[model samples]
Target: MKKAISLLGWIGVIFTIIALVLTLLTTYHFTYVKYFNDYYTLQWSIFGTMMIWAANMMVFRTNFKNIVYPITCVIIACATMFFMYMKVY
Candidate 1:
């Protein structure tokens, strides 16, 4: 279970990076990557949030020493979602 949680967290990080890059490219008119848009980025962001949430739940339950990372993950996920929600740059 712990391993699974860790895997989810890593996957979340990857998805978050992908989403961020995609968003930035689109926003700045760097359209080398085609056939992608806000909708796909939104999906990536949502998946990232879900994965981080699951990982955080398990990590919190385990009483780990390094709680800061999970907390940071949750904060980043929430902020990303909020930015997407408000359509803010």
Candidate 2:
């Protein structure tokens, strides 16, 4: 049986996807004039999504013991962020 993800989780997934895409695009091709790179932005977006899911869990579920979801989110976010950081430049 598959666990159902909430609306906020879906949103977080979407945000992560967009962040990765933007980072890839900015890194390979056209660089935005104002910013040096998009990795920081990617990292922040991932972190933001993780935060959003965390808040959702706290307000709705409030189960600290059942932390698999939130921790997974944070790890994926931070890992992707760091991957971008290491892969880029």
Task: Please give the distance, in angstroms, between residue 43's alpha carbon in candidate 2 and its true position after superposition.
Answer: 0.6
Worst 10 residues of 2 by lDDT: 1-10
In the range 1-89, model 1's lDDT, one tens digit per residue, is 76776677677667767777777687678774553445556555664766566576655665665666666656766776777777753
TM-scores for every candidate against the unseen true structure: 0.52, 0.52
Runs with alpha carbons beyond 4 Å of true place in candidate 1 = 32-89
List RMSD in Å for every model shown: 4.1, 6.3
Q: Write the per-residue lDDT of candidate 2 for residues 27-84, one digit (tens) a residue.
A: 7776543342556766766777776776566556556676777677667767766777
Local error of candidate 1 at residue 71 (angstroms): 5.5
- Where model 2 places Cα greater than 4 Å from the true spot, the runs are 1-12, 30-36, 62-64, 71-89
Model 1 per-residue lDDT at 5? 69
